[model samples]
Target: MTRDDLAGMLGEQTTACGPARDALMAGGDFVVWDGPVPAGQLARTYRMRLRRTQRRGQPTLALAATVDRLLEAEEELLRIGQIVAADSSWTFMLFLNAAATEVLACTGVARIGTCPWTWCA
Candidate 1:
């Protein structure tokens, strides 16, 4: 689905995953796609893309640190079955997005991936 479509869907889904949905909206820079695995494929699930918008030399170290901590602390919230992970590809893509992860390694930003627990199955 398109970004606007996803935004509307998110708006309607507040009760489904409020914290995660709110977190994503608060992020201000994210895109929605049908899948994140295999680079380009459609699925019943949704995938979000968050780019590191901060300019270079802006000092993302603190954010990175926080992301790392969250990732460690919220392991259960972020966990998903192999089938879901494989179908969505977001968890893997987020882990593999080295450049983005480099800046967001320790910030609330990483929680964006963990926020959508509804995806778990």
Candidate 2:
């Protein structure tokens, strides 16, 4: 779907905390990726990589830092993309800088079940 489409969808969603759509839109244009791999799988793969790096004592990926911010709500993040499964079982939202170069965070939403993966890069 296009950015405008996604924005409209987000706008329709309501929350007790506030207008999540505003927070989501503040990041500028949204980018959507079409691929064979599902979002959950992608997140799992990235998480595995992160574990490997942590085991080796290497600096974590930027995505990990972004995920930390997501958990802590340290700062408002920019929304950049969305990854939805073909069966509509799950969706993953990608966040990054306004320029859309560096990825800031990725969060997944599951329709039929709970999603356990949230990865960043």
Candidate 3:
């Protein structure tokens, strides 16, 4: 996916993950993890991409703004998955793209209506 596509999927632009996002935006090669792992697991490593964008210091000025935009984009991407995605990959991708564990936790709570931490599995 392109940076704009990821941004659109994530909701807003990122200041930290800018370079990676820019890479994707500019049509750079990317490797998507599309295995059977749950959303939580899938997102663990990918969020680093967002962090890097802020460190790059040009496009996405503040990590907060970048985070805000990413959350919105994630919501949008999940909503879209209600149709196009035949498997968990779509949600997995966004979950992976998310900036923080809190975002994913909130998303899980929204999905299950309970704190995931309280669950045994």
Candidate 4:
């Protein structure tokens, strides 16, 4: 999927530091590698290198937790894809429900205002 597609999936306007977008940029890098035998089951491995920010004071941490949520959401999407392959009648609705469930369950902040990503930005 394209950067726009991933942004839409996450329900956020993909930030400048987004892993998908970074992977597409010139000389940019983002990757997820399989963990070694020892930590394989419990570890979710990912690496992303973003440009250094030149902000005026201490930069607040943002999106670290969100990344984990998105990863879980991705796994849910894969499962839904397999189900859709087997039974296509209710594909659209099933996919939508799966996506919504994943996003809601993984969201760190409570739903009180706008999208939590807005706060991160």
RMSD of each: 15.2, 14.3, 14.1, 15.3
lDDT of each: 0.26, 0.43, 0.30, 0.25
Cα lDDT tens digits, model 1, 1-121, are 3323333433221122233234344443443222223212211122221223142222211333333333443422221111112223222112112122121111122223443222222
lDDT minimum window of 10 residues, candidate 2: 11-20
Model 2, TM vs. native: 0.34
- Residue pairs that clash (backbone atoms under 3 angstroms), model 4: none
| Cα distance off (Å), candidate 3, residue 92 | 15
The segments of candidate 2 whose C-alpha lies over 4 angstroms from its true place after superposition are 1-67, 71-77, 113-121
lDDT of 4 by residue, 10-117 (tens): 333223223323233323221222221211111132112111111322222233443444444553332111111121111110112322322121111111123212
lDDT of 2 by residue, 16-99 (tens): 111223434455333554333333444455557556545645432244543454444334434346545455444445654444
Model 3 lDDT per residue over 85-111, tens place: 122111112234333211222121111
Off by over 4 Å in 1: 1-4, 11-16, 34-121
Q: Kindly provide the TM-score of model 4 when superposed on the true structure, using C-alpha atoms.
A: 0.22
Q: Candidate 1: what lDDT?
A: 0.26
Which regions of candidate 3 are displaced past 4 Å? 1-4, 10-14, 39-121
Please give each candidate's TM-score.
Answer: 0.22, 0.34, 0.26, 0.22
Q: After superposition, how far is residue 13 of candidate 1 from its true place, in Å?
A: 5.6
Best by lDDT: 2
Candidate 3 TM-score, C-alpha based: 0.26
